[model samples]
Target: MHFGIRFYLLASLLIGAATATLYFFKGHLYSRAEPLPLEKLVLATPRIPFSSLVILAKHNNLFAKHGLEVQLEITATGKEALEMTLAGKADIAAVATLPLAYIVTRSAQPRILAVIAKSNYEHSVVARRDRGISQPADLQDKTIGFLPGTSAQFYLEALLTNANLARNKVHMKSITIQDSQSALLSGDVDAVALFAPWDKRAAQALGESGIVFAPSLHTTHWTLTSNQNFPITRPRVAEKLLLALLDALTLIGENHEASLDILAQEMEMSRADLDESWEQYTFDVQLPQALITTLERELLWIRSHGNVPSGELTPVAPLPDFLDYLSFSALQSVKPSAVRITR
Candidate 1:
């Protein structure tokens, strides 16, 4: 073969190899198409048992299924969670009805989206044996630490009412949830109104010496709320969020055993412990009529506490339907049955 022919053949081979390499890389580029645009949301969680639906949603990628990326900000209490939402740090929050009631009266901007879970046995007034505080009545004249501005106050009030003790009769010390247990064990207070984990730990520590009285006679719901701006600016996102939560509730209802496993991990409690307390709660999707009645009753108590001006809101017989705060348009569009809260 001629030298020029050999060189030409070699050049042709090199060009073909380069062409094949380019095509290979081009195929890879197509395979790695642009990632889907995920809308981001900041959700404030109070880390309560009633918040298990939110926990399940977060853990199981339920939000992702709805094209959302939620950043969970674990707050100590629902009031704090709402504070984060107000401060522009969080878009949505899981809050107790009492705290939500307190804020909703003051600010006309926020709205309740949905109820995650409702529990009657989540909170209690724990008294120390050393203080001779054997019952809720013993809390009279006794200094008690409470997480003020949260459901702790309401729980305390309910317990006192049941015991027929006047609110002014007892002294209240403002205590954060983080310090509630230590404050009790260290004798800083005679008793404390605490929620789960703290409530469990306090009872366990006090053993036979303590009296644990659960004050929530009706229901304690961890409601999903928005900062008003979120629902107004991102209605679709809000709708999707509601849908995801409903889906989470469905999962818990249909596969209770699996839901328990998820709750055990999410609540950081033993399965047996959850089982014992399971009957106290009704974990399902419904805009219960009780929510309206409860809110109406608590709104009075909330007003009595009165850091807010009462005249700001006209005292009315029946407030707007609780559903007014909720946008079921999403639910209506997705599955009309989900919005069939009344029927």
Candidate 2:
């Protein structure tokens, strides 16, 4: 009986060892056999909320599965994406509709391919209590700092409109994003208009002495744009990219925690911090019906705000051609319901 028991024990040990070895080899083989992305695409993304979807798609293997190898180049803001596209550093860019008004006028315009997502609450104003900026009304005659773009100008205008304050009531200062926090902390500006991680970090840096004002411009749309000549040359790749983005958007909608995890990782924010403001962002992959109208209004604001000369840029005459810049065939091919552009 003792010899029989010993033989059984030894046999069980050998079987367990062999099974473990086979499982390890099988996993290794599968990893080694994983196919590479058929096409490499470099995407330009502002280190803002809009970057989340593309980053998620890349990290979750959605792009690779769709045969795309995506490399994300971090930009200062959506405006920088357009510059990157024009300079040939990137194939696709994430640009805001407000900024597109100015960009569409460039001799070689960056073609807006699709709307990746829309968010009303992406930007915010963080003020220090020491500056006597406790309320919107208190902002009267106060100095404010904004990032280097019409989009930042857009945020400031919306805030002024909401407070019923005239443009002259608030002194505006243009500051680089990297220097904004220090500017605010040092009282170089009474208050600062910022977005996402920067605004959130500013609030945290001030602790109980900070006031975060969210005067959202509900008409804001985050869009995917391409270089002046990319989509026309490579329509099929652009289509595949749109399909992948649609998939990524679906994942973001259906799996909130998973998407948030990816955003937090890329944005370098703690999960808890991301959750605080994540709910405010709207994730959808539809060409908004109001996109053109919003751009028109944004163009007016841009002109009046003097970010660009109104006479030099004519959004009206070029508006129709700008609409043509969007290619909807790829979107319709993958998901019919998402094609909501009227005209």
How far does residue 40 in candidate 2 sit from its true spot (Å)? 1.6
The lDDT values for all models are 0.77, 0.78
Q: Show where candidate 1 strays beyond 4 Å.
A: 1-35, 305-324, 340-343
For all candidates, the clash counts are 0, 0
Residues 1-343 of candidate 1: C-alpha lDDT, one tens digit per residue = 6999999999999999999999999998987785767799999987667788888888899999998999999998888898898788899888888776766665456677666678887788888887877777888899998887677777887888899998789897888898888888888998998887678878888778777877566568777788766766788987888778888988887888998898887777878877878777777655555777777777787666553322345333334455556655555665665444563
Q: Write the per-residue lDDT of candidate 2 for residues 237-258, one digit (tens) a residue.
A: 7887877877887888799787
The parts of candidate 2 lying over 4 Å away from their true place are 1-37, 309-321
The positional error of residue 158 in candidate 1, measured at the CA in angstroms, is 1.1
lDDT of 1 at 319: 43
List the RMSD of every prediction in angstroms.
7.6, 11.5
The candidate that wins on lDDT is: 2
